[model samples]
Target: MKNISLRAGRFLTLGLVLTGLGLGSCKKDDTTTVYGNWTQDASISAPRSESVSFVINNVAYVGTGRNPAALSTNNVYGDFYALDPSKTGSGWSSVTPMPAAAGVRYGAAAFAINNKGYVCGGYGYVGTSTNITYLSDVWEFDPATSTGSTVGSWRKVANSLPTPLSGAVAGSIGNVGFVGCGFDGTGNTNIFYQFDGTTWRTLTNTYPGQPRSGAMSFVVNNQLYVVGGTNNNVATTDVYAYSTTSGWALKHYLRNVSNSTESYDYSAVSRSLGVGFTVNDKGYIAVGGSTLTTCYEYNYADDTWTLKNPFNGSARNNAVAFGIGNYGYVGLGYTGATRLNDFYRFAPNDAQQ
Candidate 1:
C-alpha cells in the first residue's frame, strides 16, 4: 500500500511538469505571432474622406472631408468628433464643427504642434473649374477650447517656390513643419520646404525618387522617409530618406515579395498627400488605392517589410492616420465610389498572439 502511494505521487508530479512545459510553449508561440500586428479596437462613426485626423492628449479628433453626395462641391465639413481610447463601449463623440463651412479639398495636409492642430494646402472649388482653387492657406484649431479661429487664417508661405500646390506631405519636428513632394496643379515635384511657424524656407536638396504624387512621407530617427507614390497613375516602389544636413538619399526599395513585377502606386496613402509616422520604431503605411484595407509595416532595424493584418474597418484611400501612443487612428477617405466616415484604432500588443 505504501509503495502504491509513492507511485501515485510521482505520477502527479510528472503530469504537472508536462502541463507547465506545454503552457510555456504555447505562450512563446503566441508572443512571436503577434509581435508586429495591429488589432482593431473600437470603430467610430465618421463618414468622409480626403479629410484630416490627429491625436491630442490621448484623444483623437477627426473632421473636414468631402461630402458623400457632391464629390466636386467644395463643401468642407465642420463636424468635429473626439475619441477616447481608454473608455469602453462607444469611444467617440461629436464636439464642435469649424466656425465656417470650409470647402471640399482632398489631399490637404495636417499636423499638430504645441497641442494645436493645423490644416494646410489642398485643392477646393468656390464655384467652377475656373473657380476651382488650390489653396496655400493654413488654419489652426485648438482641441482644448474645442474652437477654431481662422484668425491667423490662410497665409501664402511659398513665395520663392512654385504656385499654390496640393497633395503635399507634411511632418512636424518641434515647431518646424516640413513639406515635401507633391502635385503643383500641373505636375509632380521634388521640392522640399520647411516652415518655422512664421516663414517658409525651401531646401535645396532635390529628392531622388521620380516626380510623383500621393506618396507617403514620415520621419523616423530624426530622418524623413518618402515611400510609394504615383507618377501619372504609375505606382512606384522606391523609398527615400532625407536628413537636414545630408539631404535626400535612397533608403530601401519596397519590393513585392509575392510578385517581383507588382508595385505600389496611387495605392499609397499618407496622413496627407505624402505623410508617414513611426510607431514602436516601426513604420506603418495605411490607406491607399487598389488595396485599401491593405496595411504594411517597415522594420527600420531589419529594413524589411511585412504585411500585417489589413485594416479592419472600411477599406479606403485618401484618408488620414496619426499616432497618439501605442495605437494609431485612421479615418475618412473614399472607398472606391463611396466616401467613408468610419474611424478605426489599431493597437499593437506584445501579449501572446
Candidate 2:
C-alpha cells in the first residue's frame, strides 16, 4: 500500500507540471505580434516643429516652422530644403526660401498638385511676441525651372483660402488640392475647400466626422484618410476617408472598437499633430501629443489597425513625415523645450525592432 501511495504522488506531480506548461503555451500565443522596423536616417538641415512638408516630382520639400532656440522672440523660419531619397549621405539640399511677404510662419497647410507645391494659411507673431497675425495668403513653388541642385521660385497664388487658419491639414488628388479642418483662431472648424489649380471654392458637402485641429492626412488608393487630432481641446481617435467621388465616409477609429478582443489596447493612438504617411498602400501615424513614440498602421483594405514598432527616436510631436518611392521618412520636432533634427526610415512589413 505504501508503494501504491508513492506511485499516485508521482502521477499527481506530473499532471500538475504538464498543465502548467500548457498554460504557458497559451500565454505565448496571446502575446502581441509586433510588426515593422525603424532605422535612423540622415537628419534634416535644422531642428524644427510645426513645419510643413510636401512632395513635388517625387522630391520632398520641408520648411517654415518655429525656431525653438528663439521661441521667446517668436522666431519663425521661411527656409526650405529638398531631400532626394535616392542619393546617399545627407539627402538635403537648400532651396529658395518661402517669400518673406507671405510671413515666416508655422502650422501652415501644404500640398503638391501637378508637380507644383502650395503653402496656405498660417499664423505668426508678426513683430511683437504678443501680437499674432493670421494669414490667408497662398504661395506656389515651381521646381521645373530649377537647374540641377538649384530649386525653382516661389510665386504668390492669386487666390488665397477664403479664411485665415492655422493647424490645418491639406491633401491633393490629381490636379485638385483639398484643405480642411483647423482652428480659425476663434474656434475649431469643419469646413473643407477645393483648389482646382486656380480658384479656391468651399465644398458644399461637409465631413461627417468631428472637426479637429492638428490632424494629419495620407492618401492611399487615391482616397485621403484623415486621422487623429484634437476637438474642443480633447484628443480624438476619429478616422474619416474622403474622395471626390464619395465625398466622405467614416472609417475605423484609431483604437480597437470591434467586439473581438484580439487587438491589443491602442489607446495611445488618439493624439494631435502626429506625422502621417502612406507606405505600401498602408497609412501610418507616429509620435504626437505630449511626447509619444508609439506608432500605428491602418490597413485600408481591412479597415483595421496593426501595431508597428514604436518610433526609435526621441519622443516628440509636430514632426513631419513623407513617403518617397518605397519607404516612409519622418523627422524634425521638439521634445519638451529641445528641438530635434534626427530622422528615421520606416519599413512596415519588416521584422519588428
Candidate 3:
C-alpha cells in the first residue's frame, strides 16, 4: 500500500495517447450481435470475495476466501467446493478444504493444468488477527482422488513465488501456468512468473504495462491475456497478451464498440476486481466495472470486442468466475454492503430478451 508502487503507472492518465497502430478494431452492429441470458445457479456454501477459481475437465472448483466476521469484514478460510455445470439442484459438493496455510489466503492466483488444480500466492492474515502477510506459496489440488471436507489432497509444490504477492492472476497455456501482476505489499508489480506443476520460475521479459493486481485473466487458444485492473486506484483499460511466440505485447486497446474511431468514450469495460472466464476460443468478462451490470465478449482473432449479456445478479465485484463446457458460471463476491452467495450461469447463444 505504499504510494511508490501506486505511482509507477501514473503516466496513463486519461487521453494519454495510446493507439492500436496495426491492430484491427471491430465495431459492434446492432443487427449482428445478440446477448445471452445469465440464469441463476446453485448458491455456494459461503459468500466471499478475493476467492480463487478455475475449471478442470468441465468441473469448476471454487475455494479459499474469508466470510464476513462481525464488522471486521475479513474472516479467511480455505474450503473448496466442486460444481458440475450439468448438475442442477444439488450441483455443488465439498472437496478437501485447503490446508490452514493455503485456505486462509485471499487474492491468490489459480489455474487448472492437466488434471490438477493450482492456487498460488495471495494475501493472508497472521494468527487470526488482521496482521497482513503476502504469500507466494504454490499449492496443487487433485480432485481425482480427494474426498470429503478433510484437508488431505493439497500439497505444496514449490519454494514460493519470486516475491510475496497478492491479487496476481494465473492461467495455464499448454502444460505451463503463467502468473502475472499483483501487489507485493510494497508496490504493484508488472513482473511475471511461470509454474510447470512442480517448479516456479520467472519469465525473462517484463510486462509492458503498469504493475497491477486484481486484474481479470483467462486463456484462449493456448495463449494468456491479462486485463482491467486499477493502478493507484484509477481503473485501466490496457491489455497485455503473452505467449511463447510473442512476449508481452500491447496487442489491442479497449475501445467502445459503439465508437468506430477507437474512442475511449464508447467503452464500458474499465473496472477492476471483476471475474473473467474463457468459453471455447473466446473470452467473456463481466461484473468488474466500477458499478458493473454490463458484460462484453472479446474476439482475439480479429482484435475486436462485442457487448454481450450483462450479469443478471446484483452488481458485485471480486466475484469468482469460470467456464464449463459451453457456458460460464459467475458468483460469490462482495456487493460493497454484503458478501454474496448467489450464483449465475451464462449461456451465450440463448435467445436474447
Clashes of 1: 13
Give the winner by TM-score: 1 or 3: 3
lDDT of 1 by residue, 16-129 (tens): 467778842343321213233444555546566666666566777766666665545545554566777777776667766554444446566776666776667677753234
In model 2, the clashing pairs are none
- Model 2 alpha-carbon miss at residue 108, Å: 0.2
Per residue, candidate 2 scores C-alpha lDDT tens digits across 1-353 of 00111110012344446777884234433244566678898877778888889998678999888867565324678889888877778578899886656668888899999889999988775433455577788899998776355678888999999998899888988788988888887888888889988899997768877788989889887888888889988877788898889788887565544343333335657778788898878888888887788777877786766667788888888888998877888899888888788889888777745
How much does candidate 3 score in TM-score?
0.84
Model 3: C-alpha RMSD to truth? 8.5
**Predictions ranked by lDDT, top down?**
2, 3, 1
User: How well does candidate 1 match the true structure in TM-score terms?
Assistant: 0.73
Predicted structure with the largest TM-score when compared to the true one: 2
Each candidate structure's TM-score, on Cα atoms with residue i matched to residue i, is: 0.73, 0.86, 0.84
lDDT score at residue 106, model 1, on the 0-100 scale: 55
